[model samples]
Target: MTFLAVARLGRYTAAAEVLGLNHSTVSRRIAMLDASMGGRTLVRTAGGWEITDLGRRAMAAAESIEASLRALGEQAGGDPVQGMVRVAAPEAFTSAFLVPAVARLHRAHPGLAVELLAATQRVRQNRSGVDLEIVVGRPQVHRAYATPVCDYSLRLYATADYLARAGEPRTVDELAQHPLIYYVESSLQVDDLDRAVQRLPASPPSIRSTSVFAHVEATAAGAGIGVLPDFLAEHDQRLVAVLPDDYAHPLSYWAVVRDGPRSTAVAATLNALDEHVRSVGVG
Candidate 1:
């Protein structure tokens, strides 16, 4: 179990946290497993632990055992819908959607726990430790299930004060004369978002950040016109849409689940998220 956790999470500290054990204990167990296996199974890398070929074989066997145990638990009525389910998603989605969904899940199943990894990146083929990922655009993955969760719009927005001072651009071509605020071009990983940014008039952004919240904040503070998600900016009274009909960019959010039999807890979390998205359509 310790080896499985480390292999899935790629970090001793993260494995320890999930397993409710100390870091030292997790390390010691891995060391013992390596000794018993007669060779190294994991190696530390800049990203995290890289599983060796031996580790992959060991992981396969361990997973089979885990599946068997879970089935046994279910047959005996010993397994409850409770445990940790780790998810990776965009920062804005985490704050705007998943947080509330989890809150509702907790109210019903207090024993369940969820760890949200706020990120904006493509889903990895290996997946590391994330059970589910909410990614922008449809995900291309091997041996995983990808489903569309929701579609949201991104539109140009500027503060009323900024528009008053600088005047709002009426057309996409006119937008080139005004400064723009958006994600840093160099570090943006999502192809869909990058394509949208590339379609905009070619002008260096006045401000760039990895966080969508920052874009909204900067736009709200009169920094510059920002290409922001409708779900986030539409509710802010300070911001007004710029050419809403002409400049709207539609983006879809997809949920990618690792291929396997999901535990009851993970299934419940997925269901909660789906329910929440259905209840409040992403604007």
Candidate 2:
């Protein structure tokens, strides 16, 4: 944890602060670890204290050890499928498909309890005490164990009232005239913008919220048309599909881990989440 903390935090001082130790103590710990391995674990440069190649390998090995430890715990506990799991996901998704999905998982695994850290904020597995994450974007994050769960197929949705008041849109061009609910897209570092916001051809400021979940709520409140993830919008009684088949913003849901499941509860929770996603299918 020490080596990786410094590596990830990118500052010996910051890492030292996090560990509640002096800077020299942190340096000594790194130096000692390096002495044991006979190679430098960190490199000093203009950027900051960066993780050397050796350090990265060490971190991976450390994570592998964590996985082994969990395996050992499962073997020792005798009951490997009982515990609480904390998952971080988008708010609207949590309020919609995720709740039903979680209920389904509870039905399947009676011993497992789920805690959702739902919001627009992206919480890292290592930084946050989260077992799994159901992220809708940037599925490919190196140095983490990830499994594919579902696709957040986003489409334009609107309340029937909003559509009735404001004329229906048949074409993408026609949508420009309507008061569309727009929001900030800052959950993950999306590389492919063209494929992300498929419902919107280009950015034009529809409503301007810092959260997609907020956008969904606003859409349900008859704010206007909104391009929302199907998982987050499917169960919204007030909101209905406007043009699901016409456009698609399919983002993958990843079951990612920073260091893998630490406790039996976390493991069970992850298992329950997997089961739920399978049963729900983002319909």
Residue 127, model 2: Cα distance from true site in angstroms: 9.2
State, as a TM-score between 0 and 1, how close model 1 is to the true structure.
Answer: 0.82
Inter-residue clash pairs, candidate 2: 83-265, 182-207
Compute the lDDT for candidate 2: 0.67
User: What would the per-residue lDDT of candidate 1 be over residues 34-97, giving only the tens digit for each residue?
Assistant: 9999888899877577689888788888878877887887799774567788999999999988
- The CA lDDT at 104 in model 2 is 69
Quote the lDDT for 89 in model 1: 95
Show model 1 residue runs off by greater than 4 Å: 22-79
Worst 10 residues of 1 by lDDT: 257-266
Instruction: Put down candidate 2 lDDT per residue, 111-181, tens digits, no spaces.
Output: 76677876454335333445567675556555566766666676789999999998787877777777666
Best by lDDT: 1
